[model samples]
Target chain A: MLIMKNINKIFQTADIQTHALRDFCLQVNEGDFVSVTGPSGSGKTTFLNIAGLLETFSNGEFLLDGEDVGKLNDNGRSRMRNEKIGFIFQGFNLIPDLNLYDNVDVPLRYRGFNAKERKFRIEQNLERVGLASRMKHLPSQLSGGQQQRVAIARALATDPRFLLADEPTGNLDSEMAQSVMSLLEDINQQGTTIIMVTHDAQLAQRAKRTIQVKDGKVSELENISRQHNQAIA
Target chain B: MLETGLILRALARNKIGALLIALQIALTMTIMVNAIFMIQDRQQQMQRKSGLDEKNSFYLTNTVFGQDYNIQAHLQTDLHTIRNTPGVVDAIQINAIPLSSSGWSMALQHEPGEDKDAVGTAIYMVDDHAINSMGLTLVAGANFQPEDVELRKEGQSTWPAKTIITQAFAENLYPDNWQSAVGKTVYISQTQPIQIIGIVAALQAPWNGWNGVERSMLVPFQRESKGSYYFIRTEAGRRDELMPIIEKTLAESDKKRIIRRVTTIEDTRERSYRQHNATNKILTTVVITLTLITGFGIVGLAIFSINRRTKQIGTRRALGATKGQIMRYFMMENFIISTFGIIIGCFGAVALNMWLVNTFNLSPISFQLVAFGVITLFIVGQLAVLYPARKAAMIAPATATRTI
Candidate 1:
């Protein structure tokens, strides 16, 4: 569960100040698969960053699982992010130098899991993403869809309460994107909360709920059942 | 263990960079070890005791400019006037002063008929007052008596028969039993045999550059000539006060002879070791400069690596790595490289020392100095990698999710 009240994010330069996000408010209950859609520079990623504890909001009252995120320092934020939030970036972002197993092992390592526990979690998650047979292969050796699956496995290795994904299928083909979307839906049905940011309306329609961002503000919120039917029509 | 694996994997991606840095570290360690050894040896040589009363003794070289002056009379008058001076403890005329770098040397043989093979030794021609004036300790036998003193004129054909040798020289002549050398006869040449009447505990020769510095002897003879030396010892803490006075007295005794140089024994010893000290200073400077350059090179490489891997670092950060973890990752990478270099440098250092030993006869490198070089490089590697690592740690995770 997460909540944000009147969040404001400002980017300052030498002679200009830009508002990345202003007066933004949103709430998602546990197990919700929410997709955020926005045009370029509409502050959708900024909202996701603040929600995931990766970036600080200049002015906000943000809460995740009933804890005030605004009061945590850098280290506390990192701990919160590690213990509760998993991230799937658009680029996959798997460390190229590390093999698939090591890529999935990253979050578990930061969580201070013992070797046995880390191995079990890494294998289980990689298997869940259908990549356990290729644990020794590096990210560069895999296709874009396979790399994304590895990234998902890496995010799930920590067993976080929520997943923050920014354009998770941005680089894949339609078939690969559909498979990744289905996998995310399956993960959501298993009770892991997921918030995805995407520009593709069809992909955004696959979520349980969809939020539209514009001019650094949320403009619309709708259940995706009707939107999904409308998108296919 | 996982961190190490990560470091190794990352380094494997940039093999050339890692190897370059490691080779730099190895070269630095090699130069550092050998230079430090040379400096330490030179410092030890400078600190060695010269085995003379350096604090209260001075030597003056007199060169007579006039041809008609009586050199022997002037020498006696100068010695008498110097002895009668207020602070003068004793004064004697000799052919050479200790540590003056101007002295007589000849080869000594164990038997009279031995040819082509002899132990080279410095010969000091001094009067009966030489032992007392130079504060030499007579460890065995007796000092030269007044009647034993032989005055050699300009046209003398034979050398002195009775001589006193140092303990070190005695050991060189008779290595089996040096104490037996006190009354033994040692031939200066094929037929010129001299009797060793006494043995002193220690006496260093004027030329300390060679390994035979400790092998020296004193002959009972008065050297009076235009180019002779006068060694004077004053009471404790009175040498500096008596130097100008001695020079004035000698000048007043005979105007025909000019004092070529007036200096303390301590000053002469310092002058003798000046080249050694200069070499030590130069080696120290080289070590420091090389260390700094090596450190900066590591920093530059780390910075370049970090810049190239910014996205990977950001990904790790987003995966929940703390800033400390990120910094430690970079530092661990540098540590691995430094360790590899140190391991190779150990062999390189020994090889360099072996070359030096075979080429110049230098002492072998010590294990302690090798350990010191390793530790120094380790510390410098870490320090050099620190700034770039901190920068890597500070990268925002949002950078990873950026579309580019």
Candidate 2:
């Protein structure tokens, strides 16, 4: 589970102070797929960064899996990130110099997994993403969809309980975007909680829960698919 | 588990920068090791003893430009005046001084014939007081007696019968037993017999660079010539005080002779090996400069590599790599590259040393020196990469999400 209450983030420079996030509040239960949708400059990325423990919030109560994230030091936060949360970037941030298997092995290496354990996890995740056959190939050698799948496999290699994806299909065609969306649904159904930040309304509708962020705060939480199913019943 | 294999694979794909730095380290190691070896070699040569009281001795060129100069009478007068000086320990009229780079040499044959092979040695002409005046220790036999002193005019080829040879020369001439050389006859100047009356511990030749620098002997014949060196020894700490006094005394004695070139043995030794000293200084500078350039080259390459990999480093951070892990990755990368370079440099050093041995007749280098090179370059490489690695580690993980 992940929770944030009145989280705020400010960016300060020599002559300007930009309030990126103000009084943000969000909570997601176990196995939930939450999609956050917002316009540019609505603080969606800042919210996701703080939620993923990639950056610290200015002041707030934030708890991830029952641990106070605001109280953790940088090293402890890194350890929590390695152990509890997985990330998939829009750029398919696979290290270009490493092959697909090696890219997947990166997080697992930081997790202090033995070579045999890491190899098993890497193969399993790459197979889950349908990239096992091309595990030896580089990210540049694959198509956009396949590269996104490899990124998904890398995020899954450490068996983290939570996943944060920032516009995972932003650089892909609509077809590849749908395919990656389906993969995320599958991962969520398998009991891994996921929070996806995107601008596409159609893709946002596919999640079990959707929230709209505006003026650095979540303005709406709508369970659109559950309501439509209930009306059909 | 470390990221060593990952880093190596990455470097294999992008090998140019790392390869160039490695080659620079290799070249530095090769030159540095050999330069240190040559410096140590010269230092050892400079450390050799010249078998004289070098610290308390002085010599001057007593060139007589006067007509009908009673060379023998003046030699006695000059010796009496120098000997009676308050601080003078002893004085002698000699043909040459040790390590001055200018002197006489002759070959002594076991058999007196044109077909016979002979051993070469430097010749120093002095009187019976030669041993005491030059501070030579008679290890095997007695010093020269006064009756054995002889006078030899300039351009005369006649030789003295009694001589004192150094232990090094004694070892060469009588390898069986050097002590047996005393009182034994040997042939010098192609047939004249001269007996080795005593054996001194050590006496270097006039030329310090000569291979036979330790092979020399004192012949008992004060040179009655137009020009000769007045070899004087003073009590400890008085050589400098007495040098000016002696030069003034000899110059003002008759005005018939111009006594010039007053110099101490220490100064002569310095002038004799000035080239060796200068070469050592230059070599030391080259070593230091090359090491610094190689260090800076490593830093430059590492900074470039980190700048190029900024996004990748941020991604790694987002994937949960601690700052320490990132630093270790770069330092380990430098270690691998330095190890590769040291391997190539070992062969390069050996090849260069072989060339020197064959071409310049230098001895082969030591293994310890090559190991020292390997370790020095490794430290330089690691230290050079530290700052850039720290910079890479400080990159925010949020950079991975930014479009750039």
Question: How accurate locally, in lDDT, is each candidate?
Answer: 0.87, 0.91
lDDT of 2 by residue, B1-404 (tens): 58999999998998998898889888999999999999999999999999999999999988888887799999899999999999999999888889999999998877777777888999999888888888888899988888888899778898988889999999898899989989888899888888898999999999998989999988889888988899999999999899999989888887988888989899999999999999999999999999999999988988998998888888898889988988999999999999988899899999999998899989999999998998899899899999988988898888888888
Which residue window of length 10 is worst by lDDT in model 1 chain A? Answer: A223-232
In terms of lDDT, which candidate is strongest? Answer: 2
lDDT of 2: 0.91
State the lDDT of candidate 1 residue by residue for B274-372, as single tens digits. 899888888989999999998999999989988888888877877778899999988999999999998888888889989988897778889999999
Model 1 - which docking category? medium
Instruction: Please give the RMSD to the true structure for each candidate, in Å.
Output: 2.2, 1.6
Please give, as one word, the docking class of candidate 2. high
Q: For residue B383, what is the lDDT in candidate 1?
A: 96
Clash pairs detected, candidate 2: none
